[model samples]
Target: MTATLTGVDVAPPAAPAKRRRPVPGWLAVVPLLVFTAIAFGVPALAMLNGAFTVKDQATGASSYTTGNLTASLQGAYLTALTGSVKLSAVSAALGTLLGLPLAQAVVTSRSRAVREAVLTASGVLANFGGVPLAFAFVATLGNAGVLTVHLHLTDHGWDLYSFWGLVIVYLYFLIPLMVLTIAPALEGLRTQWREAAQNNGATGVQYWRHVALPVLAPSLLGGLVLLFGSAFAAYATAAAMVGSAVPLVTLQIADALSGNVLVGQENVALALSLDMVLVAGLVMAVYLPLQRRSARWLA
Candidate 1:
């Protein structure tokens, strides 16, 4: 038998400390679900309905038909769609090519100030597109503008209101966005990997070609996809700069909604929106998989 201490009294074993029940993960997402339903789901349903339903001009009778979607795929609409796709491809390609090196430099820099300055600028410029950006470009690169006059770009056949100019404007933002997106991936590359390559008698080019490139492939592709989507859906800048000269899907959609070209084409605008959604969905599909693959390596 154990003897009790002279001046001490024991406290009762605290009624087994209560174990709090864990919160359900789904409960945490309820607010997000509600917001999504209200924001995206409702608008999507409305768009889908509008895309399919048509009203008779004289009778004001509404009926469902595939004509809107069919029309969206034909003639001028088709041309606009193709043109937007080509422009997006060109801008995204150029942005990726230019951004990769800049981002790589940022990641490899020894100076913190240089890296911070670049990243800060990129953040601002990536979100710097739209009307103001359009105006800025016009002021500098327009036919009678300062740079055009000074550099004699006019004599060189430069046209800021053309498709190529639109691509140039897109690159202005896209390259910065690429820099932002890919920098993290570049940073994820470990020194050990390079050391391992060097230990195997690999040159800098060989190390990148065999090892680093393989690791970064997913990230590069993902950045390209992001750039493509940004270029694909861009509206205000192109609208302000090129106007109807570009024949973009966005411009066509705007025209359809505003009835500038033709009245009673709102449903066609919705159909164009549906097409945009599909293209955006395809981009997401590619991006999500690449993101997951990169996470495995980078994380």
Candidate 2:
């Protein structure tokens, strides 16, 4: 009884689990917000002002006016805008069509060597750009190029400087982009699904149309939009290949920046601003529908 009276040893109550101070969410976002304000918001506002404001050359006076904006909508500016949309669409479609098969081939192959080779080749071609790629294309297809010289194909009248020629050049960039984008989706597809589809007597086309495409549609569409944007924004390849002979929107913008002969500098600024607005609208239009569809599909 006297021994039981000794002080009993006991562990101290565990310090209330140290409450992690909630990370200030705003801190994480401040950098992005600052970047947006500086990089996009201010510049966009300035462009809007420049698009409307008339700057007098002699008096150095600037006044807000809609005349520049209106002027940008007419004549060659309008034509170039339309051409850009058409070109982007055509190139995107072509890239997606070509990429689907290549993606399937790469993802389905059992051989790691083949996959590595294909991916390495794709990466190399994708990075190969600007003047070197242009010159390579020229050396292969130009009137005085190897193909023309060796095969005597000049009689067929193949020209790589035309609108279609730009499209062809664009594909070199587009195909690899599509492959890089779509390959991930293909790899994500479960092997059992294909086997199940085969066991159920579904033809390969039916399997793709019904089983695979629906699953892959979101990725495909996203990649297509990316390809479209790439082609739309591309400058050097088109410039080097076609130059001023073709009136691309990028070329027009470049001319504006350089004070080229065709469009006045102010008008050029207005034209570029107009193009930015249009492209922003287009991106939103495409992105919204795609996002909604992807959400629904994923849900």
Candidate 3:
């Protein structure tokens, strides 16, 4: 029609393009959501449900009750909980304080091989836990162990099965863990901040106090909480190393579940597990906000 009517300069109008409907982006994460539901949600719900359930020994009847939870707050159980918290706090503090320098040293090192070796070692050691780790410490520091035989540590009243001993053992893994966690935050620290501070006549200590430490505080705190959780939930290492002698909440929970001390105590174990879950949840509740705040600056 345009060619036939070319002399008159007539043209037909173009057709409009069709618009496509928007796809829901969240659908892409459906598999992850499903996997999380199966992996974490279901188990957590089951554990929570069991924590509040009670079984009557006389009639073998089950009922909803808070007795187990209430019982968890009294006597030896409470002490165990307190002990776990104390261990976690001390270990996390030590790890954060000590690991920061190591991480900084690694970052500042000119040797790429040294940095790689340090990071690799940190990665391996951070994950070094459970039975083997316990055995390693025991073989190194036990009464008749190599170091003990060489130095006579037991003669000086240094027992590797005690609380302080447990802390020392925990530091093996904890320090490396903190190193891995805080190194990225340390790297995130831009050099310009330090240079600018120095140009403004600020000293090294002042720069670190006013700029570096303040910026790193949230990440360090977050790593501390993570370390605390790691230590709090630890079972195999402490159990294999010291057994019931340590009185950790994890051991208490294990004992309750095993029913060695008292029959039908699994419910109490569930209650203890619930208590741990709550504590961890409370910690994350505080940590997430700080992590978010840190991201704002880092980003």
TM-score of each: 0.92, 0.84, 0.92
Question: Candidate 2: lDDT of 116?
Answer: 84
- Point out the worst 10-residue segment of candidate 3 by lDDT: 1-10
Question: Per-candidate RMSD vs. true structure?
Answer: 3.9, 4.2, 2.6
| Alpha carbon lDDT at 132, candidate 2 | 80
Number of clashes recorded per candidate? 0, 0, 0
Q: Which of the predicted structures, 1 or 3, would earn the higher lDDT when compared with the native?
A: 1
Q: How are the candidates ranked when ordered by TM-score, highest leading?
A: 1, 3, 2
Name the top lDDT candidate. Answer: 1
Tens digits of per-residue lDDT, candidate 2, 1-299, equal: 12234576555666777778999778999999999999989977777777878768889788787887676667777677678778889999999999999989998899999998988888887666788878999999887889878988767777888888888988998898889877877887777888999999999899999988998888788888888888888888878888976677777777776777553475556556666577957876886687566655544
Per residue, candidate 3 scores C-alpha lDDT tens digits across 13-98 of 88988889899999999999999999999989988888889988999989989999998989999999999999999999999999
Report lDDT (Cα) of residue 280, candidate 3: 96
Candidate 1, 105-192: lDDT as tens digits: 9989999999999999999999999999999999999988899999999999999999899999999999999999999999999999
The reply for model 2, stretches above 4 Å from the true place, is 1-23, 288-299
**Residue 245's C-alpha lDDT in candidate 1?**
92
